[model samples]
Target: MAEIKVEKKKPIWPWIIAGLIVLVILYFLFANGDDDEMIDETEQEQVIDTTSIEEENTANWDNNRNDTVGGVDGYLSYIGDESRMGIDHEYTNNAIIYLMNAVQAKANELNVNIDADIEEIRQKAEKITQDPMATNHADKIKDAGSDLTNVIENLQEEQFPDLSQDVQEVKSAVQDIDGSVLTLEQKDKVNKFFDEAGDVLNKMS
Candidate 1:
């Protein structure tokens, strides 16, 4: 009998085919994943853009309206109801002037007596600037400072005299309110001033 002849089949070709198929599948999966990541990034960017647009729209809307302002009393001296010299209302202007004068007098007395008390008054006044009802009065209070400063300057120039005793008394009353200290007598005075100031403010509108 002739020796049996045998041949070994090559396995390399099958392995190469399987590797190529696996690489192709990996490539497709990686490419699809990259596309999904890009889509997510774009969505996030669009959301940020939409939020910015809404904020800008809200700001524009706010800018168009004449909103009621508070804490403008300091600058009230610079503008008037009719845009004339100082405030236009006679009663309101005079009452504010009176209040300012009183504050100045009290401030002077307290300055020599207890500077700490004056500081306390200032702190209280600053706090009042935050109140909803008091914000509108801030301008008036600030303007009062200007008015009193002007008077003091005039006195320094010898064009004005020192505040009178009545003015001093009035100032003491206001200082009590400004310092959040109220005696029975001071309380009565403060109530009167409040009533008068309310009338003046009501007339402004």
Candidate 2:
């Protein structure tokens, strides 16, 4: 028998060790992948939470319009467009109507009676602007704004006689004026009225 030079079987241990190394590398890769996915999910949740907080803050700001005189001032100020030409007859007329409406609403809230009729004032303002002979429609609107200021002042004095009533009524009236429009002068008057009224209300509280 030829001396069986049985080739020593290639060490099986080396092949087994290589296989084990490959499995270890694969395990580390899979673990790292899972960790990356978890990190991504956590970051996404944080972003969502931040967005929700921002939305809530915005909502709170809007809701403030219904609580205080300053809020009404903010609402009205936002609506008035200074860029709109006061010389435009139609625009002036519409501005007067809006002013009258805002005044009337505030008066009603305070349980004060305004002698002027809002609808009548609106109609008259419109007619004055439309008349070809009218040369001073803008001045007329300014006069209306003045009249509104007078009414607000009168209310601030007389309507707020009772602290409970004044506080309650003012609270009820504190709401968003979504579509209010005014001229620059009218806006100033409105802001002044609110300032005075707020002082009175604060005293009562």
All-Cα superposition RMSD per candidate: 15.5, 13.9
162 in model 1: Cα distance from truth in Å?
A: 39
Candidate 2 lDDT over 1-205, as tens digits, reads 6776667777789899999999999999999999999999999999999998867645543433223343334335533553453444444443444445555556666666663544444444555445534555435544444444455546656655555444443333322111133333344443343333444433432
Local distance difference test, each candidate: 0.41, 0.49
Residue lDDT tens for model 1, 1-205: 8998898877798899999999999999999999999999999999999998767645532432222222124223322332221222233333343333333343343342323433343443333223333323434443343334334333333322343333343344344443233122233443444343333322222
TM-score of 1: 0.29
Judged by lDDT, which candidate is best?
2
TM-score of each: 0.29, 0.37
Off by over 4 Å in 1: 1-5, 62-205
User: Which pairs in model 2 have colliding backbones?
Assistant: none
Please list all clashing residue pairs in model 1, or write none if there are none.
71-135, 72-139, 73-138, 73-139, 73-140, 74-139, 74-142, 74-143
